[model samples]
Target: MILGHTIKDYKRENLLHDVITGIIIMAVSIPISMGYSQIAGLPAVYGLYGSVFPIILFALFSTSPQFIFGVDAAPAALVGSALLGMNIQSGSKEALAVVPVITFFVALWLLAFYLMHAGKLVNYISAPVMGGFITGICSTIILMQVPKLMGGTAGTGELLELLEHIEKTAEQINLPSLILGILSLVVLLAAKKIMPKFPMAVVMMAAGAVLTQVLPMKEWGIKTLDAVAPGLPKWSFPNLMLIPMDEVVTISLSVAVVIMAETLLAENNFAQKNGYRINDNQELLAFAVGNLVAALTGCCPINGSVSRTAMGEQYQGKTQLMSIVAGLSMILLLLFGTGFIGYLPVPVLTAIVISALLGATEFELAVKLWKVSRTECFIFWGAFIGVLLLGTINGVLIGIILSFAEMVIRSSKPASCFLGIQPGHKHFRDLAESRQIHEIEGVLIYRFSSNLFFANAGVLQQDIEQELERRGNIKAVILDASGIGSMDITAADRIEILYKSLKEQGIRFYITEHIADLNEQMRKLGIGYLIEEGCVRRTIYIALKDMGIKRPYPLEGGVDNEERSASRKRVDNRMQEFVWAFGSDTEDQIERQIAQQIKQLKQNGDVEKLLHGSWSHMEAFDEDEWLEHLEEHLKEIVNISGKDERTLAARFEEHRREIHERIMKEHPELAQRFKERRHRLDEHLKERRPEVYDLVVSLRELEKRKDME
Candidate 1:
């Protein structure tokens, strides 16, 4: 037991607060425990019986500071469903006889779980599957309880049976019971919103008990609970030989798995929030011990209670002593205060159970998944509908299968992107993220952001082939293997095939920026020639050096466009980058700025004094870089303003004259850069479209001829 270790730092002054918190938890648990007991196919009092010894035992063994174990809804509903499948009646002699055996098996399964250290398996059950499975169980239980409000017994089993029960019970509608039930639900839901921390269920149960005694509710068709027989329950072993071993095993394993997944998730969350760690395997042992005691005491299965734990935490309950006090408090209630339970109205209790289950349902998670991924939302709905139409076990199986299938699909086509240089940063980045980033002139750098396995090998081949086809004259292809942690036979075979295919097409293939383990894996997979032939490199810089490509590596490629010379490719890339950022609508976006800069130039009679960034139309750290981009877009700006080519040529001449005078007089160092920018744009346009280039040039020639005349 971890009890001594848990209370090692126990303060003498903390006793009173733990006692008070325990009392409040007992107050809240009375109606809830009774409701879940009914759900477990036992009479209302067994819920209290389940709460006491089991909780005290769990507190003794648990590492958690504030997790509560009791007869909770999920396991109770599962047991109740088991009863229906076996044709056992609810709250009857046969059900009471068979249920303890189920609890015995649940404990046995939990022991096996602890022994095998199977708690780690909970990590594999995704959130949508757990949320949907639990919500489905709660919804099923809600439908079971709905008949109580209409003056009928709580119906059990799947959706069709419950719907049929409601239809059959429609003839037995008691006006007083229905009205009381609706009013009780109103108060319960209202209290949940208004004072969520208060124990409103105890107050409502007290009111129902008083009303049943004072008014002739029995005469009015309002059912009341049978009075609980008090004092501690006698301890005895469950006669598991009564039920078939296979049936019991199936039901018990399902219940144990549900308890571990749902309860551990919630408990671990509380532990993390409170800055503590829980031992998963030890927690499994605690559950086994708690449930073993529950079975010996003739109670149904027990589980971690989120509601009770929240109340304990809210009341500032510290250490496992809080669970001890809560258990002891329930023991007192069983000894002295079982009288009022007989007068408690059935609909009122039904309302309390329904209210709690409603709160427990993960409706918000469904909404969130809907907005995030419809496929995941489908999984949520699949589990929910499977529970309602099929059963809990099948519902959970369907959810797990769907989750696994989705995971496989995601792995089959992982994220891959083309890498490019951003100039200021030495390393490359994804080109799709920014317009400023550019690819190398004759190299394709593709990054696959996951391990290369059979499922995604085909995706890698397809992405590379498509890029190569779009980029015509690629001399080399570089695979950025930084994201790849490992490779499989299928992926290695595919890589070898791709290397041979590209070699046939006269393109060299290289893999770079990967750990040495990758090369070792490649060698083991029979592709060691890549390492020997200098095709596998430790970094992109080394790969470029091997390819005779150097730094400021040509970020100008006609590969995605068409084959072109170096100068044409460079000028074309510059224009393409500019148009990508500030496109055809650049005239509208920076219209005022351009006009102001032009007016400032005409007013001052000097282009050097013009405001910067007015024509660049983007945030710029390099004035020369953006100015070169502007020279390419002068044709578009002139055409958009409805100016003739003659007028545009004259405007271009004025800017050229300003640049020459400014570069020669003040910035003599930049004379060569300014001279390079002078005709590079015209050269790109003339090569791309000869007629328009000739028309613009002829207008300049006519001006020169007139000056000669």
Candidate 2:
């Protein structure tokens, strides 16, 4: 009972600490949220609304307890533009009323995605593409705000057209506003560089507010917040029936998807860095509910703000305490701090926005992107131009569409190659690199280094056709399936078409070494049995041999094992005791047995006879020098007797495999080479076996045929 009480007290104490941390995060969030609201062209009160009930609601249901969900710059700018289209301004009741409605619809869209578990869909927007889009957006924001910061009448138009007008009126720019703007930019940039932890936005806002008290900003025609309404949270709603429901519905859906995607990404990223988990579905619901609240009052589209979340994390905030505390802090500010904010200058707000934009911009990635992928860089620039000319929503749409188009383009041209192993090298390399290996006649081994999917299906077909065209005598085409990772229905259809087309051309098609996943996919599509499964050489060799194609390397001179007399053949004397089975006690024990056998063979002069007579049996001829070295060091095969050279060679290979397996099984820490040698020897023994027919003679015939051409 005492222990239980102590545990309960500990939990309570931790909860209190979490609550305290939440309060500090909220304290920091309020000022930033207000500043961001100005960026959205909304009243300062809207910022409070953003950090209040919506935050609390998100805290209740959001996956990330630490993620401070509130009004952010991106959504605010988007909402402000949307309101302008509806002939509404920031402080107007009409714009304020619609803010929550837009937010609600956006939340609904996010909820749909979460329910569908569309987290993986975020992969479509590659990092390079996002980097470009962010840079473009930042550039646009800076340019758009420059005229306002200079206190100049930059005629309202599209972003690019407005920029052109601003350029023309540079001489008429107000000196005081320009100075203020420049100072703000410098301070914001400096703050980020020198004291990243300090709230530069707030500091700049304070400076601008103080400057307004002494300077006659209105005399200079400088704009300011001017007025603020102080009150507790209130209920409100946008007139959905009166507004253009169709436009609202469509635009709201698009905005919602973007907000959800960005928010979920931000939440997941922060959660991972901080060692927590994010539930996409719960976040969707939370934001959806919050947006409903925003729409009821006078708030614009709101999403999880990355800046505020970062602040919360920096302050070591955990759980919903931070968001709740931040909300309460906002309530206190609303009751006391409304009048002071009205003195804040537009130039300072511009500085804050600019700083936020600069922070959001991925300058490093922008530089790397140019060198990394020109195609993706092009899409980002293209989208930037589109958005600067058309609008934000259109620009993002074009960027996404272009991204999809790029995928199609890459799939249209897959990489194809002919492969072979270099002479005296075990690695299978491209035939282009290892030109010394003679091409087996009437056979071509092609490897498709991509998935057999719809995008590259036609490309695969064209490559196959090209191979056939190049080699008219090609009777067999073996697909090296080692690289093919996947296949789709369209790819399957194309393969079926190719199979029939080749069959008509008197050529047999085969697939070799396909991975299990692809093999299963083929089986599921009912075409597994159509293609033979094995190594490219084995499959092609067997197929050609069956089709009357001559073997490249047939057994030449000794009596065939199949035809040899039983008396002439060495006895399997230890067959009853299963002599092939080596002891599992240790690697040293099995190695000692093999060494003894090799020594006996050497002392008996069997090694000397083989060295003098057979090139293949010589010590230098052995591909694995370790085996030959061990043979020289050993005394005799005492346990198993009378093993001929053929049997001994086979046993030696087996011994190597056994020793490798023992090292891997028992001495796992020895070296990486133990695993490599084990695998190599296993593959060699499994793949390289003597064929009954001569293949060299067939190659000679094929060479003559090619020479005739």
Candidate 3:
């Protein structure tokens, strides 16, 4: 689908640039593919064969527009080891014949994986594990090339065996070859730093060819690639009768998995960087076709090459057209330019392979892993060490096992915190971080910061019990379930037990902010009926209100203490008039009249003055009946005054002076009584309920500002 889409949106303007980029990638791919063919235990010519048809096939079918599939070191080394274990000699006719059979099976496995839609299996390999695996492969590749770098035969086996072989052959090292390899390494590194955009690998290979032809280095014990077969690859089926089907299938499965993981990682990284999307299943199918084509042409298995993909990206590869051009260029080289490749020194190719592998090592990622998570750092080291001591496939397996164990450990001991209401805000924050925040008087707000599952059920219970013990006076508990994305049956059962236990202790238990999916989970698990009626709320505020507890505020408002007292006295005089006029027989009627007058005053746009005049009247009533009625009337006034507090406060202050003057002139005799009553009320508020006094003052100021607006 992506190939069809790319062709549909093809642009004539990008053709020249794409063609140039293709040629550049072609030049860079030639020598590297040759060296990797040796790594795959095949002749250098087969490497050229692997690159040509494989590149064309993948480019033609791939969903990722920029990715270039070709011979890569990891899968090559894996196939080489599998063949070597079977006692197949490297670079021999028998080994060459067997490679295509192995590759064809690998292709079949990839096709099977595509059919299964198994692309998401890559998610199981965490970043640290993948980094460690690549780092280990880089070390293995560099060590394997050490013998070639020193002008001797390449050694095999584990890292220590290879090191010992190099040491045993130290006396036979050729000086000219060593010098040429060192020079090549220097040139490659310098070019990378100074002119990274240029085709450094091609330039170095060409220079190596010229030097070998002009100098007497061959006489001094330097080896050259010699003559490469000059022709296009022939299509032929593998002699499957000669190979063990079961052994080939096992090796093919392993190689297929490694290729899938590495290729998907490279494809996803480049696609994200360039702002494109790739279908994973389509990528798997493309790899299947590429490897099948390579097998038909008698070449090793192929996968996406990170180095070549990055080179194509750096050179501004625009589309699959670049890949097509690259495939054709390889064909051109096979037709006429094979003679030039024959003169290139072996040491130079070794240097190119070593340099590319070195670049693939993620030392910075290792450092970051150490800094962020020590357990993940251990996983990286486990894989890295396993590869060095064992082999590539075994090392990755060890890393995967360790990563799963670490994940289980983390989930079993999830981080949790007690929440306290932050000052001046409704949010319940972790009290450990905000020490100034006060805990609610009889309520506990607890937050569990992980998914609820079997491994953590007991731990969750322990944590809740410990918190309840630490805070002895908590009568209502609100479990903030916002962090819990899902829950298992074990966790739901544990919660049900906790609910029953808290209910027996006379403490109300509630859950807040749980998602709909989690609610459905609880119901299916039979824990929903265990929770008390009205115990589930959408937010902390709603939960607190259901428990009959009001939120706390700081003892600060726009009105000063003296101004608030003056306003209270004016309201007290009005309440005294109502009390005297109604007497004891009509107390209920008097309360209704007062409420109606307050409502009327609010509608007449005099809310600020009315609220100021009513403040002391509300306080003068008895606490149970009269205060409840007054609070109901005040709530109505708050709704009428609008929800914005600042505007209300501003309007209240503007009308304050006028209300005080009018009250003083109309009731001079009652003024002294009002002042005394206000003094007593202020003392009572300051001594017993400072927060309530501040809240009442704030509400009046807010009402006043609304009236003025």
On TM-score, the candidate that comes out on top is 3
RMSD of each predicted structure: 19.8, 16.5, 15.3
For each candidate in turn, the TM-score is 0.70, 0.63, 0.72
> Which 10 residues in a row give candidate 3 its minimum summed lDDT?
554-563
Q: Of models 2 and 3, which has the larger TM-score?
A: 3
- Give candidate 1's total backbone clashes: 1
- The TM-score measured for candidate 2 stands at 0.63
* Per-residue alpha-carbon lDDT of candidate 3 for residues 389-490, written as tens digits (9 for 90 to 100): 887667878988998999989999888887875555556688898555657766778888889999988887888788889878668788888889888988
lDDT of 3: 0.73
lDDT computed for candidate 1: 0.77
lDDT of 2: 0.60
lDDT of 2 by residue, 629-678 (tens): 34332224322345553444544555544554654554445436554554
After the best TM-score superposition of candidate 2, give how far the Cα of residue 354 lies from its true spot, in angstroms: 1.0
